[model samples]
Target: MDDQNNFGAQSTLSMPAESIPVESIPIESIPVESMPFESMFIKSIPIDLTSTPATNWDNQSQLILSFESMPIESIPVDLTCAPTTISDEGVKLQFDPKVIEKKYIEERDKRLRDDGIDQYVRLDQERQSDLYAGSPSPRDPIKKEVDFLIMGGGWGGLLIAVRLIQMGITNIKIVEKAGDFGGVWYWNRYPGAACDTESYIYMPLLEEMGYIPVEKYAKSPELRKHARAIGTKFGLYDKALFQTELLALDWDEESKRWAGTTNRNDNIRAKFVATASGPLHNAKVPRIPGLETFKGHSFHTNRWDYAYTGGDTLGNLDKISDKRIGIIGTGATSVQAIPHLAAGAKHLYVFQRTPSSVDVRNNQPTDPKWVDSLTPGWQKRRMENFNTIVTGGHADEDLVGDNWTDIIRKLSVLGGKNQSTASADNAAARQLADFQKMDEIRARIDNTVLDPATAEKLKPWYNQFCKRPCFHDTYLPAFNNPNVTLVDTDGQGVEKITEEGIVAGGKTYELDCIIYATGFEFVVNHTNKSSLTIRGREGLELSEKWKSGASTLHGLHSRGFPNLFIVSLMQSGLTPNLTHMLDEQAIHIAYIASYCVENGIEAVEATAEAENKWVQTVVELARLQQEFTKQCTPGYYNNEGKVSDVVLRNSWYGLGSPAFIELLRKWRKEGKLDGLAYETAH
Candidate 1:
């Protein structure tokens, strides 16, 4: 089948004006709708135009002009160019390269800024000490022969601990630094502490736990409660080591055990070690000038300071009635918090380096009837439904999520309203149509906001995928309040901070409090006191190995780091529904653990061969989705301003969630388990 020819353009044969009868080819037969000028590339100056009789060309001199292959270097992506190959018969085509590359870059950078964030300066020891002046020590050492040592108390850790008990693997111990078990949820009680994806889909084990979410988008309180409930249900609360931190873990090669150490130098031995330390647990504060001496109440959103604002986690900031608040971010975390601040504060200033593409969330409660209808396989069904629609698969209906990705599904319906498939050129046209949908949403912001200038300033200029898309009914309207103000830095970001407040665009915005919504650094600073050193086999440190870039197999295990597994989205299908990704990771980890136990294997590690193949697969798949996701502004999504590198090929799998899950299932079923090694205890 000629896949290229079927999609590019309809064939148009030209005849000399003198030779053809006037009515031989109707003007309408020229295929005005089918022909997209964007797809053609001129390989050479002259082509055998005489092979097919031309219908409209003037008997031009020689009929021998050479058209260089459409400058592959300068095709505009906006123009649809169908990939084609030509023989003596006729020409084939694809989109204009110049437009696509430009659009792709702009959108890629936006995604980077949204997710691959950076530049947080660690507070000096003295400053950190002052900030925690009245707080107790962050960690407590544990000295016991715990049945099961769970490294993190986040949702993953909480869930696994519960599951272990359900499996009769009790006598468990959960180690956590925070005073509670919410993991990232406990720490990030920011102003807008709500889930962006539908709460039911985003939250995990809810139905299994017999819990109904209060809102379509669950708030921090409910999410936190869910975490605690997991711990409580599994009896994890009975022997958990709260306010405790893991210092180091070493395998006792002789005993076939793990020697766990804590900050206070206490030692304990465990038969099994579960590293549930989630990726988002570490609070990443970017380094900015004068962060040390801001001379005002300031805190990372991850560590919400209610004392400064006199409000609870519900976001009633009565104390801020007299205080001016300045927030420095516009990512997912900030998106939820800003509206509350805008409503409560005497004056609110938002310091935006880049704008997030805001969409309508329309979050509502889960219908009891609907919940009851979801039976045994509901979670899997929901996950599959979401994945198929987002990845351009045929589905009966799209449930739970309505982000910009919905446009992709809408375009796939061949005969539906706004049917993009009416033309064979639909695939290339789909992306632009999605952009227009986003533009219409953005324009709605202009219409919604009271101030035209503020609306224009807040509207994101980049493509939708450049950053993770946000859905909020309140965010846009919050800006319309007289007390709320948006201070856009036009991508240069805040200039500098003064003793009183921040200076940007030569204007000073004085504030009683400065909030750093600034995010975390990818590579933790080795020298920083907070960062723990990860030493692998042969005394090889993870920092040194990944200095050039990060690498992993399925974003889980890495080469040389045998028996070490990372809890992150590296090369795994990551989507807006974070729980979906986490669930997939949890399943992968569970399978690994089960494999070890079932096989009586002492230790399992990824083989060099497996790692190489997995990395190659990740790269190949990522390149396919690069045009869509890379357009995001500088954020962790594209590795924070560093683009087009192979080092971090296994960063985040572009395959989306469902496909990755299927891949994992197929690999496990295949039994070869391609790139892993299992060894028996000596």
Candidate 2:
């Protein structure tokens, strides 16, 4: 057992920072409740930390250290603390100098490691594999030109390809690294892999594809199958280059074409290149010392090794009945997978660094009646409704996120709304009050956890809106099981790993197997580091332009790279419902593609001024949502290690998705598409 000082250093606390200089909108005026669940990213903190008097650590393994539950209001605004003494049942707890000494040492070590300057796998550092560095041009002796070359065979890419086909752009090819379609869906086949977002709204083109999800959150197999179905539906299955990784892409000014080479040794040229390689494509492993040296059978959660587990995608892990297993990480992926691992492994030890705040996930099979009720245009309306309420925009009706609506109702009770039916006005006010309800939800978490120390640690100190809010009914209760143990590593992560198990808190854990659910890399690294070089107009490498940060009119087209589009969650749009955003992007790309071919235009790129205006818009929007910077948990949203409130601003368009789509539509209709310059085919 790790040494625990019932009393040592005082708890450090701080109020949510005031990053966005914008004035706050009152919640009392809005009629609808802003869903605290939707604002799950936002973090809140209380004032004043009263230091517990230092106590002697004797051989008291069973000693339960509990602090008095402070009220949400009573918590100090400035995070100040004073020491206190305690004498409980003949055990004299004395405030000692040793405790402070230990805390000082611990804090210093923590600062050195978690500073986000992870030297391991540093992209800037020198590497043996020049694969990351730039390589010589590997274009074919004779270019094989095509109408369109779509990168990534994921849902988004497939959709864009389908639309292009409809517009009579037949000569199109898709290059994918995976052996087949599905992109992320194909790769992540862990036992409990499923969509947390409601399947009805989350799954795209369901009615058109004539597909029905078995559960509200479709499982990995089903999701993968859906991807295949999309490819088949669009007739893109034949022209795709599977198991091929794009090596480099160089724009040939002489030919007015992009010469692209891939790992499969195929050199191809295309008039237009659409990069739909979605986020979460790359699997990130922790740089824990001795990770690779461990002589054991291991694989990432994304590449679920079913042969070792004795279960398929649907979770019947009867194979590992006698094996002792340990899984690292308590994030969303692990939350879903652990239950099955528990059932199979004789002794399952979960190595946790940071615990996730899991809300209720009332998952159920898709209702036939609900599906029947959803007609044409219902998806669009429902999607729009969800976007408006979640993003603090005025909506006709609050739909999709029921938890958000429930919180809004509570806010309305606290402060009355304009009407009982539906109120679209004062959405900003409604959202603010909804945050109040979230404060209550945080309290509810304290009430549930049996251990007070555990409860406090479990309680997320930052705003709930910072990280993706996870929903699971089974996750919390799973910890309550006698077979499972909650190893709370007070922010100081796992000490090290030994051949036996893991060395945490100076105690070694003996285990048969270890699992890592660490998650994906979020920071956008250029393809130049991956040996995929792209030279645009005047042979200026795209990498050189984006060295400081990304530059694009709408996170789609950069100024130099004409006829090239990116279809990911950049500043152009960010949404909980990824499919909706993908649909919007696909539509925009299709219009541009058709516009180019129909008008005999060879190339089109965003103008420098348009890119500048869009960047300004992203900065302005980020300045409005202070919650993203303030009160948010220390994660990718805010600079993970730094205490500052500045976050990496993203988005293509200045406004939200609905407004963005409308703008794109208007631009297409206007025929000018003012922000772009096109070169006609000679």
Candidate 3:
């Protein structure tokens, strides 16, 4: 499943040309010193656009238009006409690029906190148990031994289990903290909760399970049901331990096994262990002063209080009709839930820090005819097509045509093949595309929102991918409602929470309930996020080993962690469609596990040299990615704008998801398992 903590809502809004003014500037008249850094390269270059096509710019022409020898701050032109593609209507400067860059930096600065990731408090077992009282049917703990023990029941764990089952390895057990198998889907049951990515690609094993999503983007209920279906179809229910929090995992050198302990007082021993604990497993609330003193009813979006809200996922929140509600954080979660809150609350106050780039999410029902026309391996092909396009590669056709692919295609126009790198020309091109998309988004806010002041506050000034992009038809319109108010904090966020309500900008707004849409603790240490104590060979803690940064070969096997597979984004391929990446990791893990079992290999681990080489390669490739992240607004994506060495070390494989997958595929095809060392069983 995609990060439930990061999913946003969507709806369609017509593009308004009047929202953003476009002006044609003469090249000779404009001062070279006044140009923004991105426009420096084309300073004196003459452009004859009379022969250019009206709609799409020719590929050859794009290649010739390079921003190679320009300073980043000198470019002043807006070259893009739309969010998706460039037009041949001649170059027009919609806004001053240098001024916009300054505005972005100013907006980002106010949001930066000294505490960084520590500004939010991580939820623990006590909090989760209290929130989910009477969950998992309250089962007694037990001691058991198995061939494989998986640490999560999300898509990552489920996919691994399914692949292992297909490989004829059945002695497996999955431990999930939630009541069911859906992981994020199980927890985030708020009104309007749904996957942001298209369900066909985001939901894994759809073809294998012979299931078709009811909607192009499936809702939380359906996603959860699909998770259960996978468990039932593969007989995973019998092997799953629900509502169990794994406490610690220790490598048993003498027995060649992994000893595990859980919060429920259960002991488990397994020959192999795969930690599929998801990145967004823990929910967090901002560390606002006087938060504990608030007498008003409150809850995080991840742990939605349906009893108080009186609504299911469909958003009939009738219970709050007479109550004054306040929601903090205008992020992806707030974008999805605000409309529902506005509909039910007598008065709604949306407190904003940094605004999310709200775009058009024209969701539709899945076509039965399209589903029927699919031949064998159609899903794989469709998935690959989406991955290819999003990662700046050429595909025969755009299969999953959506906002994601469209924006990437626009960037690829100037970025060439490697989008991450900061080669002068590529960076300039990518920035131009990014600025264009964000302008369209801002224009969307201006058109959809009735109040000009509110629209201005709602406009996001950062790059498109700085934070997860939000799509919603009604989110902007919701602000137009007389009963709803937008309280933008000028990026300083809420000042404090009082007994009556929230205090922002030195003003107190009394609220009956406050909903925290602050999101999860991403970009932290894996052990801290998952709440797992993992000790490998010679008692080397995973946290200590990765204190500086991650040390793994292909993000799966670390040097000291024998028979321990880690399923996460760290040092692995990162993509918007997380399940696709998870499936790739699962397939690779299953192959190695099956091979080891069959070959009588007692233990396997990445060699020290191999791990070092992989880490070095990741660092070298990450230079471009780091530069891009540095320019983004403060958020989980850029480690709250700190970008420390640890963040750089823990960065995803810099070569993009498609390249990372191919690397693994080639490694497997060789049948050598080149980087791994194995100890054969006696």
- The candidate maximizing TM-score is 3
Clashes (backbone N, CA, C under 3 Å), per candidate, total: 73, 25, 18
Q: lDDT for model 1, please.
A: 0.58
What is the Cα-based lDDT of residue 582 in candidate 1?
66
Q: Please list the Cα RMSD from the true structure of every candidate, rounded to 1 decimal place.
A: 12.4, 12.3, 9.0
Q: For residue 632, what is the lDDT in candidate 1? A: 46
Residue 189's lDDT in candidate 3 = 82
Q: What is the lDDT for 592 in model 1?
A: 66
Q: Show the lowest summed lDDT stretch of 10 residues, model 1.
A: 1-10
Q: Where does candidate 1 stray beyond 4 Å?
A: 1-118, 122-141, 145-148, 166-168, 404-407, 411-424, 522-530, 623-631, 644-647, 671-673
Models 1 onward score TM values of 0.78, 0.77, 0.88
lDDT ranking, high to low? 3, 2, 1
lDDT of 2 by residue, 1-682 (tens): 0000000000011111121111222222211111222222212111111221112111211111111222222211111222221122111112222242243235333433455524223222221112211343344333467878888887778878877887788899888877678867777777777877666667778877877788766777777788888888777888887766787788887677888888767888998898877766555556676665555566677666777888876689987878777787777788788878876777777777666656667878777887787768877788766665544445556667555333333444332233122212222223323344444445656766566665655554333444555666666656555566666566666677776777777887776677777666555544533446788888888777876666777778889898889665555665567777788788888888888888888889988887776666555444433443333444444434432322334422323445555556666677876788888988
Overlapping backbone residue pairs in candidate 2 total: 25
